[model samples]
Target: MLQFLHICNLALLDEVSLDFEAGFTAVTGETGAGKSVLLGALSMLAGNRVDKTIIRGGAEECIVEASLHVAGNKQLAELLDELELPPCEDGVLILRRSLHRKRGGKVQINGALATVTALQQLGEEWIDFHGPGEPQKLFHEKNQLALLDIFAKNSTALEAYQADFDQWRGLWREMENLRTAERLSPEEAEFLQSQINAINEVDPSDESIEQLERDFKRLDNARELGQLSEQAGEGAREAAQAASRVLRAARELAEIDPEADALAGRLDALIIEAEDLSSEYEALASGGDFDPSEAESIAQRMQTWLQIRRKYGPTTEAVRAKRDDLVRKIGSQTNVEGQLIKLEHRAGELEKSLRKQADELRRRRLKGAKDLAAQARELLTKLGFKKADFSIEVETENKLSRHGHSGCRFVFSPNAGQPLMPLNKIASSGETARVMLALKAVLAKADATALLVFDEVDANVGGEIGAAVGRELAALAGDHQVFCVTHLPQVAALARQHFLVEKGQDDSTTTVTICRIDEDKQRRESELARMLGDRDSKSARDHARQLMASV
Candidate 1:
């Protein structure tokens, strides 16, 4: 339940605070006395779009804040938890909205920064505002389906159907895309085949390219290499011969002198090393036959690599990647006939399941629709449409959707002899308001989280009918918090709490002020009476006294 509301710098309301109770609350004043301004402030807190022009003349921003005591509302608590917002420590949820004159604004829930969408979701759970010019929400197909679901208590089943429907829809779209891809024109198919053939002709491999390049370099420089190797071999052979001669002379000298023997041994080692070097040089000089034809082959192979790289990528690895991708696409194209068969079978199965679930849902909704019509008719009779008839038109389709195959349209007839027609087409704004109110009252038990706000529900209604509207609102207040803005004395008199919105001027500024009215105060009753009739008339006072006494 809403506990308090504080507003500042909104329209003519400079500053005001209203304390509310858990039952029916009424705001009453003369026309243009700022009652609607209060509702506008509440609307802001409820996350409605803000018009910056509502800012007061000297104020740069308008602020609207509300405190709701929701200790018993587990659903709201769960929502707060889901959003990761700090819960009301003392069971008080504080919502504040600030709108600037420059079309900027901020929203806060329980002192935590929140998005407008989040605020709106929370507000929908907490309030429902019915006013003139408010869109006819009941006429919307989605809302009608939601109402039917609520009546049938089929949330779980509807959720299951919706989940499956989403999956089936996704798969259907994928199948369509695959079919389109598989239906490529012959020219497109030929182009793709040409690309594949080009990639396959080069047949490039990582190490194969590197190894071939190495072999080509060696073959290209074979002549220079062979000449260098011959020169090295000749040098080694000359050194070996000279060392052999020196070693033979040293051995002869070693016989004459013992110290010469060590020199002779070192000479022998040098000759051995020279001989090994000469053998290596000789082997290298004997180069394998260098063929010009081999070089031509290498050049041709390199040309092939260059062509492939130019057409596809800079490297063999990149070309190979493209080849793999095309291979997968070709495989999918080859298997398309089989894939289509599978998709058709799956779609058939899904269609069967959808039909069955839709039929079950339709059964529940049809039953719920009858009950809803009966209830609405009963409430309409209470609101002075004694002979009105209410009905729900369920038109079933052969397709599947999240809301099943049935479309629900509410129809109404205001008089006994009149033909029932679509509610939106037949009911006036005032009549719609009352009908919506009646539906809300009936749905209150199931819609315990929703707060119903009625603006001029008493429009075009008076006397006992007005009193019945008041009684209905009062009754709705028993299960849900009710906020009503009214000009009717009967509705105002039914409020457990009443507020008087009055406009005042001080110096250069005009301000709207709200004050809570004590029901025991006769002056407040007289004021409401004046609003209903004439202020100074004895008859009005007497009638006001009677109204108060009856309440």
Candidate 2:
């Protein structure tokens, strides 16, 4: 519900501030008294685009600001959270927009700088306008289907159907991707297989590669290494024999003199270490013969390692990873046909399930459309459409959509014996407004938008029928906060709050002012009397008083 509105330097409204209540509120003025300026200010709050001309004659900017009470609205809270804006405090949300002559405009929500797009999103969840151009919304097939779904209470069933449809779509996309993959040419298949074969033949590993490299190096210089080992062994043996001779001499000295005991112990340790070194060198000298065949095999393996590196990567690890990936790809390619068949069968099954769900939804929509159209037509009579024909037409197609297999259209004939046509193509602005009103009245409990503003809804009607329209709007307020810009005293009299828009001039500058008159009974009655065509007539005042009494 809207709590307050403040407009500054907008068109004829130089500056106007008014508080609003959560019920049917009427704004009344003569045809050219600038009542539409109030609607323009609201439209701006709803994120509608405005030109610089909307700025007052001498002002540089136009500002539209509103405070709305939006507590316990989960969808709204979620949207605000998504937009990263301040949440409503004490159930109040402030939305402000300012238009400048040269700098365009700016929007703010709850003190945070926001975008017009964000305002648009929040506006959908907050207010719904049902005026001249707004009524065309009902002509859209998507909105028409939404209304029918709401009236039918098909949320649970619709959710289930949509979930199934989404699953089917997922499967379909996967199958299509597989089909595309399976279309690979024979050359492509051969290339993948060859890469796998090349990597597998080497079967590379870090330890195996290191060992091969060592073996290759030793075999390549075998003759030199063998001769060097033999010479080192002879030298080590001579050194060991010399150490043994020294050890025997030292032992004899120790036996002769106790002072030589430490020298004798050191000679004993050196003799053992020299003997071990001599044995190790002798083993290397006679280790094994280097065969030419073994040399060739090691060389070939090394060559293969080099080739694999150049082709795939420069490291054994990279080659191994590439080999593994190629194996997986070739495996998938070999089984592509079978996978495609399996997916096709699964998708077919899902399609059958979706068809059944679509049929169920179509049936429910057909029933709901019938009932909804009948209820709206019944209310249309009360809104001055005595011989009007209104119907909700549902056309079922074989193809499927997120909204099921049925398309909905609102068709109307304002006079008897006329062919029913789609609302957008046939109904005039006045007729469309009234039809929207009737529909709103019929679906009051189901419509969740907090604010509903009706403009030009009382067009081309007067007297008891105008009062009937007023009564319908009043009834709608039970479920929504309603604002109607009306020229009829009957409608204004029925409102819980009444605001009067008046145009006045001072020094060639014209301005429009809006103020609440409902607080003062005489002022309200006088406005109503003025609407009745004669504010000072005794009969008109009496009539206005009677109308107020009825409320």
RMSD of each: 4.9, 3.3
TM, every model: 0.78, 0.89
User: Who wins the TM-score comparison?
Assistant: 2
lDDT of 2 at 511: 85
Residues 256-370 of candidate 1: C-alpha lDDT, one tens digit per residue: 9989999999989888888899888778766534566877777777777778788778888899988888777767877787887888888888878988888998999999999
| Candidate 1 global TM-score | 0.78
Query: In candidate 2, which residue pairs get closer than 3 Å at backbone N, Cα or C atoms, i.e. clash?
Result: none
Question: lDDT per residue, candidate 2, 298-366, as tens digits?
Answer: 888788878989988888889988888877877777877788888789879988888888888889888
